[model samples]
Target: MLSMLRLTVITLLLAPQLAGAESLVSSLSDEAIEITSSFTGSRIVVFGVVRDEQETLDEAEYEIAIVVQGPESEIVARRKDRIFGLWINAASQPFFKVPSYYVVHMSENFSLVASEELVAQYKLGLANLNFVRSAYSPEARGFADAVIDIRRRENLFAERPAAVAFLAPNVFRTTFFLPAIVPVGTYRVSVFLFRQEKLLAAKTENLDIAKTGLSDNIARFARAQGALYGIMTVGLALFIGWFAGVIFRRS
Candidate 1:
């Protein structure tokens, strides 16, 4: 309750600065997602209304783009080179403040809706995402590409150019998917309104993905009592091994 109130206050405080453009209001279908053992994947619907105070936008003049971003974390990407019939890490780069998961949905192809500079400014697409490296290196770009490739293969980062659809006048929506292996953390949903390739307004919403039930308890225990948990894990492994050996011997 308090957090929601705080968010409302912050939005109100920021509204004055955004009054000249179309005002966007957006919310998620679900504010919190609970993951369980049977979890496969989840879908979230972003529903929003755009208000053009002057009523100036025409049917084909406006566009919408929505991006869902997971929590930022550090990621390291390495390059391998084969030497003497052995593969070893040759180059590495550390990326800071990279989204663990990212997906963007747009009313049309980003290139069709906005200029390359505008899209790059917003970092709306995977190729345009702002990845900060620990230090400059000649192979950093390749390492960045490797990071994106790995995440793409894992279904963590993706883009859909024409995913957002219009429901009625000044209303838009899009669906975003979270894989079963999604990291448990906070996520951000950003909505942008554009007209004739010009940015009009933007809005943001937050959602939380978390573990529940037995899984939540186990995670809490492991975090709160790491040493104890490690000891217990070792003991359990030894007992399981001995029990399996005894059963096989009897057989």
Candidate 2:
């Protein structure tokens, strides 16, 4: 009887941990996006489910954060200041690796999801992004903020708090808008699950953005024959001008 009781106690102790051992099943609505001349924007929906067995895991205590980041590039933000009654480039800061596009969707406000340390570690918000500084300066902080501000204005960086929607006990979904001016390149969609400031499970999916139709043709032509493309462009402009004049004269 004592041995049976010991076995029962061990099973009871292990049940919760086993329940916590869940996996994430995730996928994007579209794996690849093509931008054409008439392309305005697109909507991407990320959906996933956490399952331990056939049954879905309870997610009331869990928080989800989704980040879609475009390719990284070196960026410089210049600051203009008034000197001799004229605004001039007084200071500049260079960021070594900055994402061209960054958008985040969160289950709730960051503070409610996790501690500042964990959020910064995972870059759950814009303020936590570790855009490395090429050089150090006392004014560099303001420059960094200025860069982020400009990106925000251009809709390249955005935050959508409380955007995650729960479809079922284990399934969740979040959607983000891709702006018309978004850069065409590879992007990463990363989803993180956190519980009480501790990371539980994380998944990353790749997304491709490329030009299609006339846009793709023009880009390829420009790369392959730059001089010819320029000449053709001028010729086309002249032809269009001449055609418009002929039509107006007939009218």
Best by lDDT: 1
Score candidate 1 by lDDT.
Answer: 0.73
lDDT of 2 by residue, 1-251 (tens): 11110000000001123225654545555577877777777767777765555344454466788898999988888988899999999778778778988999888634465777887788777887777333356578778878889889988998888898767645677777777788889998888776676666777788888778897899889999999999999999999999999999999
lDDT of the candidates, in the order given: 0.73, 0.72
- Model 2 scores a C-alpha lDDT of 0.72
After the best TM-score superposition of candidate 2, give how far the Cα of residue 62 lies from its true spot, in angstroms.
1.8
lDDT per residue as tens, model 1, 1-251 = 11111021011111323535566545455578777766677777776666666655566656778888999998777888897899998777778888999999998744475887788788888987778333355578777877888888888998888898777756666777777788989988788777776676788888888877686778889999999999999999999999999999999
- Give the clash count for each candidate: 0, 0
Candidate 2 TM-score, C-alpha based: 0.80
Model 2 steric clash pairs: none
Give the Cα error of residue 58 in candidate 1, in Å. 2.9
- Candidate 1 regions exceeding 4 Å error are 1-21, 57-59, 132-138, 234-251
